[model samples]
Target chain A: MDFGDSPEESEFRLRLRGWLQGNNPGLPTSSTDDDYWKGAAAWHRSLFGAGFFGMSWPTAIGGQGLPSVYDVIVDEELAASGAPPRPSLGYLVQGILEHGNEDIQARFLPGIISGRERWCQGFSEPDAGSDLASLRTRADRQGDDYVITGHKVWTSYSDDAEWCLVLARTDQEVAKHRGISAFVVPMHQPGIEQRPLRMINGMTKEFGEVAFNEARVPAVNMIGGPGEGWRLAMTIVSHEREPGELGYVARYTKVVNELTRRVRVNPSGFREDQVRDLGWAIVEVEMLRLHVRRRLSDRLNGISHGPEGSVDKLLMTWTEQSLGHAALSIGGIAHGGGDDTALNTYLYSRAQSVMGGTSQIQRNLVAGRILGLPSS
Target chain B: MDVRLSTEQQALRESVARVVDQLAPHAVGEIGNAERTSKLDAAVASSGWRELRLGDDQGDPLATGVEAGIIAEEFGRGLADVSFLGPTMAAELRRLAGAAQSESAETVAFTSDLSSIAIAADGQLSSFVAIDASGCSRALLLAARSDGNFLAEVDVASDEVGLDLTRPSSTLGSPASLEPSGRSISDDDLMRWTALGLSLTCADLVGIMQGAVQLSTDYASQRRQYGAPIGSFQAMQHMLADAFVMMEGSRSVTLHAAWAVDALHPRDAVGAASVAKAYCARAARDVCETAIQVHGGIGNTWECLAHVYLRRALLSSDIFGGAGNSLDRVLQHYGIGA
Candidate 1:
């Protein structure tokens, strides 16, 4: 397996790096602030204008029709430059592209591509976090619209979203998984309320508890069909589990390099145990990087996502937590005190396992589904 | 970069797996059986697998480290008592040093502290312990020297007690008054050799863990507890799943290391090898222990293969200086003081 980029990829990377050097959209101060969203939207538009937004999407859908690796190169360059994250509507777009009907695709694809609109996922509920298929959200069909009623917790960017892809029970008589359907609902409707959930790090409005109370969405907004929510949700979750089209390996490597620099600058202040821990943290990050490359290789080779994604998920959790712990250990009390970036990062790392999927849930998937081991 | 094996590499792996599977039954029943070990060693040698690292008329020279890793992994899966690695390493070293290749299987051992060695006035090596010196006719001593490095062929005087019974260990009484193989080895050559050695060990550990995970998975499916299969329990499933993760992770890193040995720069190759070895060493131990835990009482018994895997993993880890040393090597590769 060749690790070096191809000549074309190298050229694309060089061009992207040159672009990033000229156009430095500063890093976001807070994810939930209006300024951040405005800046992010402007940046997203700039990326789309430069044909960097959908590098791998089909040409029919306003993308460059390039290989997925090009997208990854763009991601790496953006991350390495410390640019704010691009709009994360890729997963939602994937679901719509794969499972949504033509009309639904026409309705949502352009807005996402042009960065004119933003979306949030409405899959998780207050009652159903990891066990998402058992959600109690109800979307009863009316004349031409379905009334959505449910509470979704940990809905990222809901406060800033113009629309949400909500999953709700459409046929309560069927099995829990088969009873649900996905719908594209307007977030600014009268019956919908978004309450910003204050995180442990005191970041407000980044993640919100969205309550849908008889919110009416046109029946045409339904993606796929009734009883297809589970499949669609799986598709979205798999995309979410990906390291992004650009990959997070470069970002993680940057963190490691920063850690090494910090340790090197204050060699005497750091304990031997901390140094060893940092060393191992570096090793873990490198392994994670390799794992991600392998996963990308599989994708490029036409291999679909499998139980191996759970392995990647597990590694991501471990590496982020380890890096944060190393940072905290080195920074000690100064980092632990409020308002420190290290403290913020360490606290945020706690959500890595709980988000995407809990580590426990990932392990279960790896054991039973991936390994084909016996299951309860 | 592609991580999947080529068609030829896949064929080689399948053939090696077949050979290992044929000998697996003997791996459990007869530990340290001289006849069994000899038969396996002879079969491997005659199969010309030992010459995999050193190309023949049919293959390219020193470009098959990946193939060697594949074979080594299969051997590890079968717990086969074959002296392929050491002999292959010796032959490669001889070729690099411009010396004649040894015909017999040669076991390579190392000592970090040269002062621990007892040399006679005649410059003959007195005594040294060779770890994992099984099924070999000669022992090659690798040690640090003032010039560059020393690699000398020695004789295995007697067998010694080793935790891994599947592979034998020995103590060398004295060398045959042979001079060092050649002059001081270059840093690049030393790095390449170390990378190859560590990659093989990593592949072996990957195989051992894979085998253990398979055994435990089978046992968990059949072994019932409280009117249900033990594997049905969340605790057992998660435990085994963690083992599977370790096994796959080790497999990924080992394959990359194998590729790096043949394709990457010497420094990068050594770094990759160090990462593979350190990760595999810890992962193998965890997988084997989890296997025993999942199997309950039977797993710990001598009749069961779990302990055998654990022993092999422990021996493999120590052979390449274990996780701590490997991590240090990694740090050193990164230009960090370790």
Candidate 2:
């Protein structure tokens, strides 16, 4: 409803910003702006081990136990400085909590909090990507355990992930959307296979695909009930619009500022005509930032982010792509000659509209849920 | 940010949606009959559905985007023809230009067969072609000079003949010669209003193209060739995928433009809206064409519903400058002659 950071939030933001200002491992001379994650992959763990990462988590679980927005502010500033990712998986454990059993949390929560255990999502099967509910993976019940068998693609954090939270249809008799269960899967279990999905982006550090065959796990691994898998999945998906955590605006700020500076190039460099959109690209980026930030801030203040997230997700990708497009404009043909820069951005942006949920699906939700229209 | 509408706005979308539901004849099968085919007269006539006409007393702007988004969705699903562009957008224009303008323009119709009039060299009225100019209301004239300040409105009877029949049209007042109202709109206001128009149109485009995709996706899933679903074909899949991507881009740009209209400089907002409109128009065309193309030879038949989207797409492009025009405008805004 308002843009001002609250007294507590401002205090939190100031503290976080102050810490980031002094402690920031600014982009390395050799490391590009985006390489913060790829370059400082291990340093990221140490940084999170300090109080700067996962702010609101319980102190017993390696956090300061402040409000979740405390983390949001940290991210906002970190993103402003284009810092490498700190522990990005605080709430990701909630997926485990909802899907993982109590034993799983007791063992892993400490490490996750202390930035030791990194978990990746393994719901996407090679064949069952968007048709996630219809995943074909099989986990046959074995004595005192189950043997997992399946291929999972787009397992975004599998490369260095210590564990994975997986969604598999435990029962197939029920329809596609129902009759499934979730498990806190161990990544290093015998028969587990992981391979980096060579992305259009040249590097692959965290995001990769995972496959499993006869991977053994204990019976106590299940989080919620056996047949309520879709509900669990819904919880994860719905949280996308839950506000604050999605740090898109923070990321966008860096892009926008960089864009403004790079917008007009010198003939010695790049000129205004050299760029296709110029000021408009910056405007689009700001529009996307405000669009998401307004909703996220409102949600942080306790307003539920609703059909508006559709507005956010949609704009996020557009602005991301626009930023990428503007980057290409500034960089020109020579900057990212091959699959390096603009092309990578163009391809990644293509997935933004495709991934999470397709833009069409968002409209369907807006029409049916928000606008109260009948199903098409 | 905060895309949730106030409860009041929600109610307005509901009300307009209900009215559209009631007035719907062709899509609902009421006017689908031969006898009622031309009964658009009873449907859109000034007296028949004055609410839809959008007079000064019509209502608020809620129905334009959010509500109209719903209406356009269903209208696309039903593949109905409502001439929404002329009636709804024209109404918004009236609200924007104001009631005083419409009424004063009406008075000029009386006592003269004035096709159009002007403030002359000395700032006075001028003549026009005479017709059955007799038996008209009292005539009056006003100053309408200067650019972006005023528009001269000359009224015409419904019975008047015109080209292009989906909806009525009239030669607008002397856009160039009208006297100035001496009012200067903030550039932000100008941008905001134009954004409103473009955003609403983008919303409508989303609805229609969604219908087009639905038409194609559904048809492909059901219609069989070579004993398999056409939806399974890689070519169709690629087409649908691209359509999905372009449509997503359109949707994103629309929301972005809407936010800009709500909160940015009006002069600059045209760029954002231009992006949305240009993207939307192009998507509408691509989606509709592919929808029909995927439907194959059977789709070309009028018996099928695909052409409705095709026609609608054609109409949408022209509404706020075609794709090419908007693209030029967007590029020109950047000082890039492209």
Candidate 3:
């Protein structure tokens, strides 16, 4: 029930705020993918050095050994201070920590923690967008290596990642889920190719299509043995939907404030309906903040991530879309003509429901898994 | 921060649920039956549920809110015909205004417009409608005035059937004198009262939605369609799931509002309450409608329980103004006009 921060949390927040104020890494100005990744890597290294990276990981694994709330504090501070997004290694680290064996953990944990390596997910394919288990990616066993051949679409950061956590089919005799296995494959091998996907916004080269033609990886790099890919993938998706991890409430607050300011400053003034719509949007953002805080409170109370994450995801989707819609209607029409940032944001909001898990899939998950409804 | 209820609160919820469950079926059966109103009123009063939110326990507002919400939720879930809210809130307001509690059940009638006053002169009062005033002889008028809040007490002249069968309405004629309470209610206290009222209403809406969803889910499991149970179809499951999500959202916001009512500042509590009411007012209606849609023909019938939920939801949605008015309140909190 307590919404305010504890004394210790306040102190941590103050310290993080101070560090961000002094060591903010400005956004990259380069258009080239190489420079963009290099800048992101440098920023990640800076955060790691400043003890802001991997704050919730155990000290034995090169983390700060702080509570998960500290990570939330860092996210809030980073978002509020307009700092460039830190490298997205939380999911990769979670996968390795939860599912990886001792050897695999020892091999990947430090690299991910130290920001010395980058990883991309290789789950979605052309035919297996929502039905991810039906992926046709194949990994045949060899003498000492598994040769992987598949095409991964929408593999974000794959063009720059040094490694990929891939899901490949190993045993065709079993069910679709059981036939799959997870592996850590080197991305720079001879048979691997990455081509950046052109976004509708005509900017940002983060997403790419990665094709692997007999890409070789040592058999020892397999995570959680064979037939455990589905479980591992679920873990990864859960981490991706981790409540309050992205500081979305803070960012949305900023957007709402800016939108309100724009509406107030408009020459024509807000009509009655516009004002009501603005009010609705504002309330939605506040609801999102409350919702996220509740989920975080549950996390602190030892509640594990479950299908409730889908609930938060659904709310986040609605909030972001509402905010974007409001901004465009208010700022776009009021200000008149080409506001690229606003337009870009509206377009990007469309992906929120599609990316992690489509809204339809999320609803299905909530119904089937959470509600125990029968699946037909 | 922990949002989970404490052990004591959990026990309180369980007790309230137990009592309401025991009395609900009978009370729901007595809806639209004037003869049973007094009996139901006596049963609820004997249970001492009205005193839970009267600030009797060390004057802790948070405890009162959480406890009231628990009771209100049970009442909504059971569709119990107990007129607890009006009496409980009137008592709280009287306490805040330093007035003595009325001997009989007191119902508070709220009006947003300050100009629509019921004149009381020469022992005859003007007529004004009081919503959800079943089993209450006295009515407390709560309205917003230009300078501050207006609070007065009057006598109910006649009872009438309302859209919500469970909560019978009454019309209050002008009293012998328009006697305002001696104590003036500050804006802060008014906000606190409004927050409590909205939180309780949200709790009721949450219960109604939860009840409807449970009914639909049970029917979906048993009702056959296309040679199988309808619940097995994705259409039914998704509909029910969406309803479940709305219910959870309403529940979450309402709980937060309830907590904020006692824990946060009055202004913050108002903000939270408005958000909670707006969300629940809209979401509960949607959930109830979805429940009916999932149930199909049976849901449309009078024998089915879906309409009962819808009726209650419709009444509760407009209790403190509908979602639009709640949103307007939110905007006013931000110093925005209209």
Candidate 4:
């Protein structure tokens, strides 16, 4: 069992590290600002331009076709260099690459990879949060297009997206899961209304509620055939849960490092519990880091994960929440220190267990599917 | 990096498992079966697992830390009543100090806190603890002289059985004297040795978690309540699943820590092992408790194996220091402490 990088991996890591030294656009501390989002997008474009993004995707999609370890290296180096996180669109990319036909891939993947065309996921509805299969979004068949009418809550980057991946019920006669279908709809269409939601952290534009009223999407944009959206959604969510593929471990490490720096700067300012909280955060984050490395190692060894992504998601949730609590405690935000950055971070951490998949649902999956526990 | 075990390592794990299955105690009543204990002891001694860290001509270990960790984990899984951790640590001390391998079985003595090796001065070994000393006569110590810290051997005095039924520990006893072995060690050597110790303990904790969860899972599958298997309930299933997740995470970190012992620098190796130790030590306790909880009424009984796993977890968790001490090491490594 070797934990050190392979020779090729080591060389690639070195070259990437050198590139990051020159190209890293240091992230702003807060995400609430419009400039932060603009900077993140710009940084994403720069990373794509420099060939540091999409290291694991096939060359047909403008990727280097390198192994996943290269992506792992990119994540570590970016975090180590204090750069903003790579844009998290791997799930969308994978959904299209796996289910979309040749033309759709040729049309959407390059723009997605190059950050030329931004995208947002239209998955959750107000009533269908964890129970996503019960979504009432309808996509009725037309001549050459499907008219989609649905309400999608928690649509991240909806206001900024050029395209949105929508899951709507194409046939109400079949089972709920089988009746669904996936579509790539333009965000600029006339029938789509995107109203930004004010996040608890006071971020207005990071999340939006998009209402599609008979929005027209060409039938060719349908990913796979009808009744494929459930499978596509499942694939997309599984990818979303993977910290290794999404570079979340690095992002958590960055947060923890920031917390560590704060504590270091004012060592006497924090209480004992706060210090211990920092310690817990550090340990949990480090565990996730090592855990992701091991997962990557398993991938290199040709081990495919199934419900294991649920485990990863759960661990990531723990790490983020703990780090968030620690950040709040150390920053003393609850006591009116009024540090917006730490408060924003702490508020954002609450969503980890809810977004992608709830911790409860994840436990159910692990228990029912992975552990073979009989469900009542 | 490839974290999967090689074919030889897998074979080693299987053989160790076979030995444990054949001779290790299967029930609380069988713990003191002298004939079975002797056979297991002989098997372990012949296996040379204790000498896995003994130095070659070039002073490198006979086997890497991953191989030694595999044996430790398997022993932990079976609750094997024979000594492995102590003797392997003794061999590591000897290897680090450039001493010849011992012909007889030996273990290592730690300070009362089990945070470090017991230090000796002027032939007087103070209050100390000998861990994993089930069949050992002598234990290794670090004798601090004006020149440097040298390797020393001390008698076990008497076996003092501890909470862990599988492994016996002798504590709060002064050995006859500290016998200098005429081999000195450096701070870096000690750090590297501690790295191995932490990695082994973490590996052991992972094993304990795996065993505890499997025991609970099997029990839940069979033990019916409310006219159905208790495992059918979401509460019980979620607990076991959570425990399984902890075990898996512990296993992952422990594997890296074990690999880092030989693959990374001494300081870096200690850092990695500390990370694994902190995670596994914390997770092992919760997992064992979850196991006991899953067994319901039977879990509290002394005859049941759930408590045994907890006992073993308690010992391993505190051997090289618990979660708090490990986090201190991690925080110190990160240069982030008051």
Could you say which candidate leads in DockQ?
4
Error of 1 at B280 (Å): 2.0
Candidate 4 CAPRI level: medium
Per-residue lDDT of model 3, residues A1-376, tens digit only: 5666789889888988899888986663221223455577788889898888887788878899766656556756776676755566677788788899999998888987897887788999999998999999999999999999999998988877898999999999998999999999999989899998877656556788999999999999999988998999988887676446555665566666766766666625777777677787787877777776677666656636578877777878878888778766665532455545666556667888898888888888888887777777
Error of 2 at B180 (Å): 5.3
Q: TM-score for every candidate vs. truth? A: 0.92, 0.64, 0.90, 0.96
In what order do the candidates fall by TM-score, top score first? 4, 1, 3, 2
lDDT of 4 by residue, B1-338 (tens): 66678889999999999998889887888886899999999998888888899899999999999999999898888889888999999988988888877876789988877888888776655567889998888888888889889898877867576889888887534646556775679889989999999999998898889889888888888888899999999888788888989998888889989998999999999999998999999999999999989988889999999999999999998998999999889888877755
| Candidate 1 vs candidate 2, TM-score winner | 1
Backbone-clash count (model 4): 0
**Per-residue lDDT for A250-360 in model 1, tens only?**
556655676677777777777778777777877787777667667766666663646666777777777778877876666555734543655655777788788878889
Candidate 4 Cα deviation (angstroms), residue A190: 1.0
**Best to worst by DockQ, what's the order?**
4, 1, 3, 2
Residue B225 Cα positional deviation in candidate 1, in Å, after optimal superposition: 1.6
Backbone steric clashes in candidate 1, count? 1
Report lDDT (Cα) of residue A114, candidate 2: 68
lDDT of 2 by residue, A48-78 (tens): 6556766655666566766554555665676
Greater DockQ among 1 and 2 belongs to: 1
- DockQ of structure 2: 0.06
Question: By TM-score, is 3 or 4 better?
Answer: 4
Query: Could you tally the backbone clashes for each prediction?
Result: 1, 14, 4, 0
lDDT of each candidate versus the true structure = 0.76, 0.55, 0.76, 0.86
Residue B301 in model 3: shift from native, Å? 2.4
